[model samples]
Target: MQFADAKERVLSLHQQLQEHNTRYYVLDDPIISDAEYDRLMQELIQLETSFPELQTADSPTQRVGAEPLPFFEKVEHTSRMLSLSNAFNREDLMEFDQRIKKATGLDQITYVCELKIDGLAVSIRYQDGIYSLGATRGDGQIGENITQNVKTIRSLPLKLATPINLEVRGEAYLPKKEFERINKQRADNGEPLFANPRNAAAGSLRQLDPKLAAQRALDLFIYGMDGSSEVYTTHQETFRAIKKLGLKVNPEWKVATSIDEVWEYIEHWQLERSKLGYEIDGIVIKVDDYALRTKLGFTAKSPRWAIAYKFPAEEAISILEDIELRVGRTGVITPTAILKPVVLAGTTVKRASLHNEDIIREKGLLLGDHVVVKKAGDIIPEVVSVITKERTGEEVAFHMPTHCPECNSELVRLEGEVALRCINPACAAQIREGIIHFVSRGAMNIERLGEKVVILLYEHKLVSSVADLYYLQKEDLLALPRMGEKSVDNILSSIEKSKGNSLERLLFGLGIRFVGSKGAKMIAEHFGTMDAIVHASEEDLLAVEEVGPKMATSIVTYFKKPEVKELLSRLQGANVNMTYKGPKIVHANDSDHRFAGKVFVITGTLESMSRQEAAEKLEQLGAKVSNSVSKKTDFLLAGEKAGSKLKKAQELGVTILDETAFLAEIER
Candidate 1:
């Protein structure tokens, strides 16, 4: 095809895709099957790839991602993103209503009830109807620019049908299906999985690479707007406006004329939320009248106009048939309860984690005892309490395992620690679990490696350690049941790619006791290289902040192992990155500047930056960034639809800054 002809075709295809996206995401009325839409998208991508110069920022294909950023630049918002106060129950809701009535001197009020989505909050800015920037809710004032990643979400509109400059806020979430698929892939790749969809959504949105974010299949449900454009007037109107602009709005949103009605909606959803494709922790109730909301005004952190009604935790009773001990990759023995089947939340519970020996004894749990089971975060099932009265005299008192259940090796409890750990490095279960942890998304992130694959590899003796993953041949992988040629190739390619991960990732993947991603980064940066870390003494390791004596000892002891040394040697031979070059840090010379001395709190998403990148930038500028808003906070950087922190910041009278203003200040 001629260049001009191809360009025109691409443009037409983009327009068609945009309309399709609006129909499907915003309206939930798809004219084409998913397969057909994918085909069209693939065609457009191919054409764009062939004619790279013709690709535009607003192009539909651009949404998947661009290039990795060196660092996120801070952007200030024009209007401060305020959060809502929490209403735990009906009484809290009534109190909020009474407070609003007293302040407004009105007998009744209208509210916009929305699902409190358990996902990442983000701000999206559009200029002249074209999608421009997307950011996380950094200290409300400043946020990291994540426009490319936002565009990757099929639900997010790249260009609105009508031209208007506006800032829209929403929750970016991974649907249940996508979350399951991604988790399955991670599990197969011998990777640690996200605990829930919310974490997965947050993690994906914060990725520096938009392409990686795109692969996670995120979706957005716009709930509010930052400012008035040619859109609508009230919170209720904003929902319609967002829908009109080809943006997805929550389907469950309703206009409640009275607090009682709002309570009814909340109560209904509290039970029905599980049926939805996404996770929702609570219900958001916002004043429907935009002018009234403005009149009622906000506290330092939260707006008086809205409140979130959190659902009461779902709990059920089950029988504790037995207490089983399982050794983790780090050799820590975790006590699991073998329970008589009971439903908690939505899924059937057969096993619940006891966490450690301390929890087991603290609960006074015993075999054959009736136990109260609850889902924490509405995800993991936990044994909340033991029904001691219902327990038979024959019930057995649980004892902590003194040896590895799988390998029968002697277990030892470290000084001042409650956890009994199997110190055997070559224990089969430990090795399998270690391999899974190494390739986890938060670690090396080898896609297509999951638990099943790890088990198969272990059973076939194809993989004995984490290093053996890098050595697996395609033929060897294909030999496993249900493993096709393409699947094998994909897994092998992902494994190959994982070898080039950063030192921080490598550290985290090592499954060191108590060393998470943040700790890994700290240690990797402090030590610079793996060899230095391996050779460091406990005293040397303890020099790092947040590294306690126990953690330091654990690190030192882990590296001292002959198995770890051999694994490290093999990884080094495989060309894995061993030296830490940490993420780009932004620093300012003015230490006592307005923002420098201030402590800022951010919740929700900004239209331009990721939360982590924004926090890092603020820290570099001598500003303290706190997770929750408090009186100590000097400013609240609010974005889009902020949560509790915005409320507390308001109540504390902290200076609130929007994304645009934050950017201006940081740049200044």
Candidate 2:
């Protein structure tokens, strides 16, 4: 076929497949059979393969097998992706209600309850109703741009029926069926499988090439808007507007008049969630009145007018078929409960964490006992309670071993801690886990080195300590399975590149006890370099803000280890960047007049500026840009239909401003 003719044919096939996908997957009303859709896709692939030069980035055949990128470029979000405060139990929900009432001075309030999807949060930008950009909520301030991949989602409207400029926030998720299918394919290909749908979604979205992201069969639901040419006063109205624009919105959302009704909505979904094809971790409850939402205000990270009511971990009765113990990287031995296969929270539960001896003793779990198992955060499985009433007298009581399962070293429980430690530095399990942690994304972010590669290196004895990784030769790596010359070269390059990462990343990579990313950054900032950090007294460490006595002791103890010192010396010899510089430090004190004392609550996506940039600008003008609407809020910066907060702000009679108005106010 001629190149132009093939291109035309491919475009037609793509449109047809998109329509079929929307009908089958999004609308749950298929007009065509799976076999027919497959045939159409196959034809498009054939045509694209024949005329490769004619294939466009948006073509359906380009979803997979794109060359890996060097790195993901940073995309600044027009609006900050604020997270919701969690309400663990009924009491917490009640407290949230009480706080809202006190702040808004209202006798009662309405709430909009929607399922909190256990997936990746994404923002899709549309210009004149045409899909423009899609980004992940990276650090709430910046995200990776993935517009071409997002366009492949058939449910997402590439071009809206109405010509409107807007930004919509939604959860990009892999359905259970799709996740299973992809994992099965990976297993067949001898590749590592994703642990869960959330991981799969995250991995797919972060693929630097849009073609790889497009092939993931990802789906989305529009839940919030940032800025829109059209106006929406309430959360419900916003949903309607999004639906009117031919975007997918969750049908399960409901408006509640009181907290009890909100609880009811949550309870109803807790039972119904399993029936749905997708995964939802909890229910998000938000104040319905935009004006009232403004009056209720926001905290630094989350909003006071909203809370996520997570369901208690989904539990299922399973027989304690066997008991096993595994030693962790920290030398702590964890008891695992091997169960008779039972489905829980949409996945099959085969094992649950016993945590430690205290938990086993507290629960009185025994072999052959029918026990209640659950997945904590829909990820880690744990035994919640034992159905002891059904336990047969023949069931045996299990005891934790006194020796490390991997190293056979004597386990010792510390003075105050419940966990028993193996203290054996050379334990195979500990070495493997430590190496994995050292290369983790939040740590050194070693590219082309996943957990599987780390384990392979450990098994082959190519790497024993974290320092050994830096010394590995391309030939040494090339000897491993699936490691060709090209792959080995890539891995070596990534390892070399990681050596220049900031000091904060190195500190976190060390896996120091009680030291997280934030704490590591603080320590790096205060100490300036690794040498200073190692030499600093515990008292000096403690003097740093947010670093308490426990953390101080941990830092001192971690550096005191001769092995750790050796690793640091090797890293230094390799010319690794060991000093902390700091983040892109932008000061908001640049200006101070127009926005003084004016509280602005920004919602939805902005066009030219990121949420952080806008917030910084507002702050520079002496304005307080809060996450939620509250009584102190003088203006509700409505982007698109700004959700329930917008409605609450309206009900409370707070002044509303679109992005243009907000920008104008800031300019003044």
Candidate 3:
């Protein structure tokens, strides 16, 4: 299409999308289906692709930036984002009303009561009604610039209705459903879970990559605008104005004419919070009129016009029903506490990890004892402590079992380790765990193939080892309970795709004793091929920076096994990638090499090359490229959007160089 025609289509699409976004996010009603909205966005993307000149910052398709930032730069707020004082009970709210009435000499002062969303506080600025900058509230005065990250929030408008300059404050939150989804994914990938929705939202916004932030499904609720009465007199009127300007405001906000009304609003929300899609910790009460807020100005850290009423802490007590022992992928025996169901943190608490035998002893845990329970990070169930006074004489003292529950082998406590391990190599439990680890996120990253599926495959006598996964057929998966045509296809596709992963992933997935992901990467890079690593002597293995004597011995011993040799042969036959794709870093002590043994750190977007490519280039030339900058860093390669790391480098007096300088030095 011609540029003029494309531009017209793009403008039309933008208007349609803006209306749909407002309808869905602000009004909680969507006129179009998600598929239909995606089709429109796809059309806009195509038009913009053909006519790059028509693409603007405010375009809906431009939500996620093309590149990630190195670090967040500091931004100054036009006005301080003051916090609110706390109100614990009805007496506190009544006291606040009396104090304000006595000071202002007014009767029945009207207030705006809003739910206090448990999220990150952010300031968004607009220039001529177009979104310009977004920032986190750091110490009220200065904040980190998160403009790119915040732009990914779908509910936030890129351009206001009227072309007028304004700034608004909102709480950026991860919805309860999204939080649960993220935690589930993290659990599957063997990553730590965020304690709650608040932490999840904060972590998402702070992500360096705009693409990552966009995937988090973050939402915002605009509470206030700086320099009140700029467009409206009352606080409630300000909400109306911003809504007209295409901003999202919390619909639950109510005008309270008296302290009784405020208390009633709080009481209603306190009971209704669990039913809502989002998380709220308290209620925010603000004086309704802008004039009244101005008269009752600022406190040192909080506003005299408003205060937050916190809810009771989320906790509960449950009875410890029983203890269950389980074996890990590495044959490490772990204990789990089975609890009588109790409601906490919007979910029922049933079980908590004991981690190992030592933790159970430390907590003085007993079967049938009443235990204080809470969700750790609001994701994992945890037994905080045993209520000694609530313990009955019928409660049984718990002890670690002497043997593996699956293999029936005698467990051993390895030297310098607290956990008991079942060392039997042919242990069925260990074999299943090894396969599970092979398909995990940091390894092959085979999606949909979870622990339960792996257990099913083993129990059904279909697969014996990790290599056997490659041989699974469509019929085999279709046989599993609840496995349908589409789900099985996806799992099979994921398994096939994992075959092309680089050598580091395979090495890590191999579950080599004493060798972690970093060590595996270094070893892979050093040898350049799986064959070389398997055949390498201890001395050759020791030459790698991350490999030590214990690690080298372990690697050598692992490869020497006949069964491992057979597994490798099968994997090779299956056509899995066996070679490192990056430039080899080990150079056998070429002292004349530039940057030999010198530490280097790369930051931001490099125009000439990707960060990983640059790291490989430096590593090949004998430099140790680190992720973080410190006093020991010999050089810092800075590119566009470099911020915190660059500042820290300067503070540490490390040698700082732009991309040009870095390229010149490395090339020479």
Candidate 4:
């Protein structure tokens, strides 16, 4: 095909994909199936490959992502993203109404009440009605540019109906259904679960890879915008205007003239919040009139014209039937309370995590005892307390397991930890969990080998360890339940693909004690090869910055085990890449690195570099970057609207540096 024809086809495909994205994401109506979308995408990709000049920044194919960014650059907001004061109860709401009325010198007021979505706050900017820049709410005045990640969110329109330049504030959230699905997937893969929907949304948005963000199924709700120059006169009208321009505004907003009416709206939603798709922690009450809101003015941190009414946590009562022990990848035996099924926060709760023995004892939990259960963050179910008054004399006190439930090995509580752990490396439960973790998304990322598939493989003795995955035959996988020819082929393909993952992925998959993804990456980059890390002593490991005593010891301990070494040899024999494929890290002592002796505490968004980048740069220069500000801190790296850390630094007489100054210092 000619270049012109390819270009035309690519343009047509982009338009089709954009429309489909809008329909599926914003409208919740899909006209095409996943297979059809994949076919279109493949055609576009081939066209782009054949005619490279036809590729554009706004093309649908670009959403797969580029190289991982070293850091996110900060963008200063045209206007401050002010927070709202919280009103916990009806009395607080009444007081907020009175305060607003007093401040505006008016008795009558109108408010636009919106759901205070429990997710990451974002600012999306448009230039000539085209989606341009997007940022996170980092200290209100400055935010990290997340334009690429924002573009991956299908509900977010790439272009508006009108060609007017404007900025809108929205909440980027993962729906409750998606959150549950992802968490269950993670649990099955033996990965740590997301605590809540809000946290999951935040984590998804902040992902360095836009493709990762895209897979999260993120949605947005544009509630407010800088409407000072707009034709709209009220907050209620502004919502309608944005919605007309292909923006998603929550459909449940209400116009309330009286505080009592506002209370009624809040009370109704508090009870019905579970019925909604997304999570809302509270309701935001804003003065309906834009002119009135302007007159009301703002406080240092929050707008006087707006207030958030937080809902009280909901709870339900159920009988604790039994306490069951579940083994984790780390061999930690967690006690879960199996309860009589009771509905709480929209879902039926059958079990609640008792956490550890201490929590069980503190809660005085017993078998067959009536207990109050609640969903923490509308996701994790937990026993709030035992209903002692309802408990009968027949109740039996719960106890922690003395032996591994699956392998029957004696469990031991590690020094400095509360939970009992099974230290047997060959334990069936630990081995199964470890293999599952090895194939998780953040690790080897074997797509078709999910938790259930791994369990099946393990049960049939087809796979015992991570290395065994690559050795599985077609007949072995085909013999398992639900394993068709296509399924077996897909699993084999994914397993083969995982062998090429970077060294950090392998290190993380190994389930090293006290080593997380970040630590794994640092070790991988610093050492360059898994062999180097395996041979390194604790002292040698400690030489690399970010390698604390605990992590260094853990790495040394992990590589020292004969079983671990044997596993590594097997993986090596399987032709798995054992070298770092990502960027290399240079030691501070290797060169004349600036900021070598300085200690920095970053507070807000940096204009040139992401917070992680800044911290990494500091580490590369031998600086000890800490999360919290203290007397020991040499400098407080303050950005726009720097919070309590800035104030604390000022009080402590620590040097404060803006993004520009911080950059200059590093350069010097």
- lDDT of all the models against the reference? 0.81, 0.78, 0.85, 0.83
Model 1 TM-score (2 dp)? 0.57
Stretches > 4 Å off in candidate 3: 320-668
Task: Tell me which of candidates 1 and 2 scores higher on lDDT.
Answer: 1
Candidate 3: global Cα-lDDT? 0.85
In order of TM-score, best first, we have 2, 1, 4, 3
For candidate 2, write residues 1-668 as lDDT tens digits: 88777877877886787677667756889998889888998898888777777666545555444565665555778877777767778899999889888887788888899988877789888787666788866546666677656666667766565787788899988888889999999999999877678768767776767677777888888888885423656788888888877788988899999999988888788788879887887899877766666666677666777888877866788999998887777888888899999977556878888889999989988889999887754357888888878966999989888888888889899998999999988889998998899898778999789999999999899999888888998878888998889888889999999988889889998889899765787688778899999999999998875599999998898899998888899988887889985552222354356566578887766776866567656655656667777778877766532444654464344666666656766676
Q: Where is model 2 more than 4 Å wrong at Cα? A: 1-73, 228-230, 314-316, 322-338, 341-352, 377-380, 399-668
- Which sections of candidate 1 miss by over 4 Å? 1-8, 34-39, 42-54, 229-231, 314-316, 321-367, 375-668
Estimated TM-score for each candidate: 0.57, 0.58, 0.53, 0.54
lDDT of 1 by residue, 263-357 (tens): 78987887787799888888988888877877888876778888888776778999999888777887888888999999665457899988998
Estimate the TM-score for candidate 4.
0.54
Which tens-of-lDDT digit does each residue in 323-412 have in candidate 3? 988888789998888999897775667888778888889999889999988663334677788899986699889878888899899999
lDDT of 2: 0.78
Best by TM-score: 2
lDDT of 1: 0.81
Clash tally, candidates in order: 55, 29, 1, 0
